[model samples]
Target: MKDIKAIAMYLPQFHRIPENDQWWGKGFTEWTAAKAAEKLFQGHYQPREPLNDNYYDLMQKKTMEEQADLALKYGLDGFCFYHYYFKNGRRVLEKPAENLLKWNDINMPFCFCWDNTSWARSWSKLGSKLTWFDKEKERVYDGNGVLLEQKYGREKEWEEHFNYLLPFFQDDRYIKVDNKPVFLIYRTDEMACFTEMIDYWRKLAKIENLEGIFILGVNSCNEKIGMDGILFSGPSAYWNPIISSNHIEYENRNGIKCFDYETIWKNVMIAGSKKNVKTYFGGFVDYDDTPRRGSQGVAFINTSVEIFEEYLYKLACKNLSQNNELLFINAFNEWGEGMYLEPDKKRKYAFLEAIKTVKEKLESVVQDDNEELTSALKANKGLSGNVEVINTNMEKQNGKFKEYYFLLHRWLQLKEENKNLSKYFMDHGYYRIAIYGLGVMGKHLIEELKNTEIRLLYAIDRNPQLIYPDFEIRSVDDDFPRTDAIVVTATFEYDVIWNELKKKVDYPIVSLAHVLNEM
Candidate 1:
């Protein structure tokens, strides 16, 4: 249930870019917008400052490295960077991601969400105006309603764009699903060419030796396109009219929209539940784009760490209940929009701690068992027995850890349904069972069968010396003991373990997962 991956949406507009300099002023960055923000109402946070005034320059490698380390420490799965691409293969504000691709030591797993929306002056009109007075005589680029246009061209343009991104797709740190690079499109509604483009990109990815490109729409995606899934962009998740009516509007002198934070989050969860397609539910740290949209901005009030964590925990539980893979967070650092998880002066690491707390609670059982496993491995590393086996399983430990936890979850579901494993074995005439693999699954099996008629005779494990089960501990090399069945708790290696056990004992061998599967 705790296996959902938490991927945070990332904003990379921190550093000063040439286009921003031309549009806003010299040395313009997201910090400029945040610094110039005015308080919209009483008790409203404005001019939000970073912790220790750490307004980072994303172009700096050290800053990015620190960001990756901090995120990983807090248990985030990865960052989904907002990728900006415009007409004719033009990309803006790309230095941060470019540097990420170039700098291998950052250690952050990442994917891209192409924000297909054009840079329109109306939406961003609150910021400093375009200083291109003596420039842009051309009609389209003339600082009209549009600052930058999003024009999707034909095959040539698409191929050019993919060629440029091929390296990123091929990068070791790029987040992939089932061997395919996961690519996100922020607004598939605006992309008329999405179906063709993604289909083409998938073919391109295959030609590059990739399985294919895994596409997930950030907002509304055309379901016919075979998008791998859809991610609900939260805080204003498409702002459904029916749900938007639930907003508890605040009386403000300005005409900006005010939403109850809790209401928006509830809407997010409800929206995800109704979706028939796969969805990675999203959450926001906070939302107030007054800096970017001024009085026209949309703000969600009554935000707190406690409330965020509560909804986030609920979101995780919801996703897990539905078998969703990840729960994405909005804006890891979108300071301009006032949505960020990076430490700030007002709430230094509270948001990050919130994520950590949720993850810890979700992985409580896994962590406890993992801690013991770690200690056991460390203590027995110098020992003569099972050293080779331990070394061999080291590479598979991470994947096996999750696999075991999944079985634990399945077992719980069966218990809730009154389909007891003990009853299943008893019904099949297996009164005595030996648990194979005394790690987490084995320990859990023993606990489940305790005091039940399905007696646990002994536990067979690789490192029998390390495990202190109530029953006798025996290595696979030891003489076989007669039992009704041997439940192989190390599900990943069930076949190999089963074969080994079958040669020595006449007992039936079954995987812990498969036992639940049959039941």
Candidate 2:
């Protein structure tokens, strides 16, 4: 099976710039807004803090090295940095990428995504605030007035833009598809003379003796716009129908809308399966832009680490099954937007662990299947002489025997693993424990522990509708019965459940796979 390349969108607004200093005050950066954010509603998590208070400055080269190491460790392919370029050779937030190019020791794959939208002052209260450094002196409010235009200039400007990117395209660490350097346009439809701009870039690449660019149009409603491919933004729009059907009233606090992350994820899975376009799907870890927009910030509630894992797993599997090898995450360190995968104070390394676990499990499935088949064949060969002859004939006459053997082998493996896991709990003095999933794995685990000394606390699942005759099914968000530890039974989402449990309880959480492997 071809390995999936997971690329995360990167934002470079963490470091200070001259334009920002003049507009927002001296030493101003994304951290300023993030630190000053207030909770707009009850249960709203605001002022998101990083793990170990690592409020890193992007200007420091060590910070970039640490980020690259963390991303590679978690199975990410690279980062598509959001590049900000405006009309007349103006650029903002270009220091990070420039610095990255200068540092040869930092080894990480990377690409670019042009944020082609015009910059405006809508980040604050829309109509109430005027842009601080508007050269035009336009007092227009509602944040729609352009502070900087994205005009498609003549040949000179186009050449300048392409020349600026030629070095990056030639770099060994740049990401490519079919030898073409991959680039993304944030909003293709919004750009003026889109086709001309792309043609110019391609011409420049050919002139430089490099492969042509593989440009993709992002958030284009799955439409082709003279680019190599399209990329679905995320659950933001795909789940609109489900959100509407639920009849949930979302209060537009300031300009921000509220929605449920679980609801969106469930719908996203359904939508993902129905997609017919050969496009890359993006996943959102958690979104609460309160740090940037405050009361006007959009937030997705009930976004536990478990939901994110399941969502990404299903999406990744879908992409692999469809033979598409690219998967884009919304962000790597979009702390201001609250969609970051970096370690945070409340859930350190949870998101990163989810990505690693899903990738490892999916990649191991085919190998495990082969191992099982080999063992079954060995066992069959060891049978009696008459039985071996009959089995061979049966395998030739009908393939059903092989299917039956595979099923039986899987059942026996699950039984043995569950038994070992139950013993592990007992050996560790964990008499009272809670199972964190209610799917097939959970059922097997419950059956294995039924006769053991381990007392079963209430079962926890994200689905509130799930029920069991012997025990009550409680939601992960609810206050459940206390236990010594939580055993995550869902094999595919073990890390996700463990991350969620760690935040809620202080017990030593364990996964079924870990227990079985140890035994």
Q: What TM-score, over all chains together, does every model reach?
A: 0.66, 0.64
Candidate 2: tens digits of C-alpha lDDT, residues 76-100: 8899999988878789999999998
Question: C-alpha displacement of 442 in model 1, angstroms?
Answer: 66
* Model number with the top lDDT: 1
Q: 386-414, model 1: which lDDT tens digit per residue? A: 23233234324544564555566667767
C-alpha root-mean-square deviation, candidate 2: 26.7
